[model samples]
Target: AKIIHEELATALGPNTPSYQTVARWAKRFREGSEDVNDDFRSGRPVSVLTDENIELVRQVINNDPYSIYDDIIAETSLCRGTIEQIIHNYLKMKKVTSRWIPRQLNDEQKQERVRLCRENLAKFRDGFWRLCNIITDDETWIYHRQIHHKSTNKTWIGEGASPRTIVRRSKFEPKNLFSMFFKSNGPVLIHAVDNNETIDHDYYIENCLKPVVKEIWKQRKSNGTKDIKLLHDNSSPHRHPHVINYLTEEGINIMPHPPYSPDLAPCDYWLNDYIKQNLTDQPDKKSLARAISKLIKNIPEEEFKKTFDKLLERLELCINNHGDYFEHLIK
Candidate 1:
């Protein structure tokens, strides 16, 4: 007390309480005569959050590190203050300090996409519909792993649940499936294997594509359409010299689709999603084969017709929207 009083008096003025007088007053106050000491207080005491709640927070962050505090609170039923305290005291987490990243296509790329869409539209609309028809094709691998519906859960099983025995598969099991889509036809043709080798250009041409093309030509002949066009993306097999030469000699027009333009392909963007939905809950080799067959068989003839009709509709929409759809495509 005396030291404090002396320091204060020296810092302030000589008229302040002297050190001895200040000490006498402090002694008097300490003898239960007065409440002179300032209250020893601070901001609200820190909270103690539960370990379980902290673990829950860690789990949520692990699952999705980009989630905000409010999202964590909503998911875990933890209050905002509790979450903040847990993050600050227990987790010692810090907010990321980084510049904002912008996602925007440059002007030149946008212009090129727009131009390509416009050119394709013009070709289809210029009274050469027979010669300029578009057919987008691409291949996708189908694994033979057991599949289940998104809604399936363990609760769906019986109480005395004995695990079902599954035969172990060999490493080289020929269970992979290769499929291709013809935008004009809803028939998703499944390529068959003659040996253990995966399908390449030769296999595709021999087993799958040749038959489909023949069927298309037969239909065209029946409809009295002499000029036929096929549109395919720039995949290695599709762009093979032999394949191109064969199609050229056969007087079939093959339009080359721009690379990295899957978003613009209706078969890739639309029909694939449709097919995947039907494949849910169909697992194992036998059931998968059945599901594929059922999906293909159930595609109404009118659906194929509608797909072709949508191409024209999309082309018109692209032009009317001033290539807005095309801009979205590349993005």
Candidate 2:
């Protein structure tokens, strides 16, 4: 304490640090700290956070981002605190939950995506009526437990006390498949497929596709419009001979959708995100469907318009990227 105080008095005449601050610095230096210079409580120790050590930590992390602090410490001569400070504060990096992509596309799939986007853009060059007329559908598995991001789970808790525990979800949690159909206006229907139901050609036509088409027809009839453009992935169930015949007979304009292109679908990119955000506490299948339905129905028309507008921007981005994934561009 006296040493730090004397140093402070010599440095700043009559504006020396208080006894408490001096005592703290003295204790820090006594605890094997090499530096006699005092820093803010949260500031790094100059002896450890050197430029060389920082570069070493960066190199080790670049080699393996998932490397733990202890591993990095073993690789370099840095202490755990210094490694963590370099990785988090200096590098501005964080561990985040991995998103689930539908499939890894090859070169051919990429070219197809680009071609489809360009063709669709040329087809609907003038206005958004084609987009508005488009009805998209997709099936997704709805789990009882929603994914909680690690970044979002942080809280202002008392020091030394852990955050409150949430109910641990199982890796093999109970889940059900749901087929959702939607237009530019809003959701048309969200159907929960029955348990033990095989989503094959016959099952899809009878249960999901047929019912969704009827609903769209009824809606268009009420609005004094007849033509409806359908958009769905090229799944086997969707491309079955009977399914094609049914759509053709019904006079629904089938929009071309490339396989493994969920990013182009509003249901996957927009509605699913909405449901995950609004219905974060889903406890059962029925409750989840109900919550999703309510949320979908409650979304404002302006929001739907904005979402549809984004399709154009995404399509243009896809074309510009030559059919590569363009999410990073938006971010």
Candidate 3:
């Protein structure tokens, strides 16, 4: 009323009707007794969502964004109207779902990898090409596991149709085999035996290194060649003092293979995979051993010749590619 009186006094000069008269007019205006009146809104007014419901919607979206409105309602015990209202009004989150994909290696990692591979190649230059001059040896376990053929979705059409089940022909204990491949030749030696024990330092020296070295020495003597280099990974047995002393006395070059760098080893990178693929349809240990033994013994003379040739080729590729594949080593 005071504001209205002041406004009237200012607009109509110093003399104007007081606040009491304006107040009476304002009351009449509100009651619809006057020309001007205010009307209050009346209807089913919009409801505001609570903070708790908004948080619940966020949790649901985080867990599984593709969840349908009905699923959310069922899970959260929230009504469809409430979910929609919260999503649109309070949360304001968009439903854009996409599968998460990982990013690939960066440029710097690739270059560093290439560099290390080249360095390893430089160290072993010309040494790999010498005939039966170097033999790389390693051991792997062959478990008595069944090999499954690729399946096809076909049904047998017969009254007495029996669904196919894998057959267990025979059982064999876990076996360990020692394999050796000449750098200049293909796989030249393989030994598979049934020993119900783990290979330890003594077993490695007595069973693996001693026999192989003896054979290599014998071959060198027959060929009237000088001492040969024995290339092997740093398996605990190979690095034992006994094995080291023996190699040192024999005047054999023991090429140092970097730890955890199986990819650089020829036996790992080339021959092992080749052998495994060729010896397919393996069901049990006895058959697997036989197949492997046959494959190793009957490796064509030419395959051995190709071993060093392939190594050289790979080395050149590594040099040319700048060790991009060897980046895993740098890390």
The model with the greatest lDDT is 2
Residue-by-residue lDDT tens digits, candidate 2, 193-299: 88878699998888887888778767776752356778888888989989888888877767888778878888788877677656666788788888777877899
- Total backbone clashes of model 2? 0
Clashes of each: 0, 0, 7
Q: Rank candidates by TM-score, best first.
A: 2, 1, 3
Q: Which lDDT value does model 2 have at 227? A: 63
In candidate 3, how many clashes are counted?
7
Task: Give the higher-TM-score candidate: 1 or 3.
Answer: 1
Predict model 2's lDDT versus the native.
Answer: 0.80
What CA RMSD would candidate 2 show? 9.0
What is candidate 3's local distance difference test score? Answer: 0.65
Local error of candidate 1 at residue 124 (angstroms): 2.2
* Tens-digit lDDT string for candidate 3 (172-246): 543456445455655546766445655677777667667766776666666522457777887887888888887
**Cα TM-score per model:** 0.53, 0.68, 0.51
User: What is the per-residue lDDT of model 1 for residues 212-237, given as tens digits with 9 covering 90 to 100?
Assistant: 67766665666422466666667777
- What is the Å distance of residue 256 in model 1 from its true position? 3.2
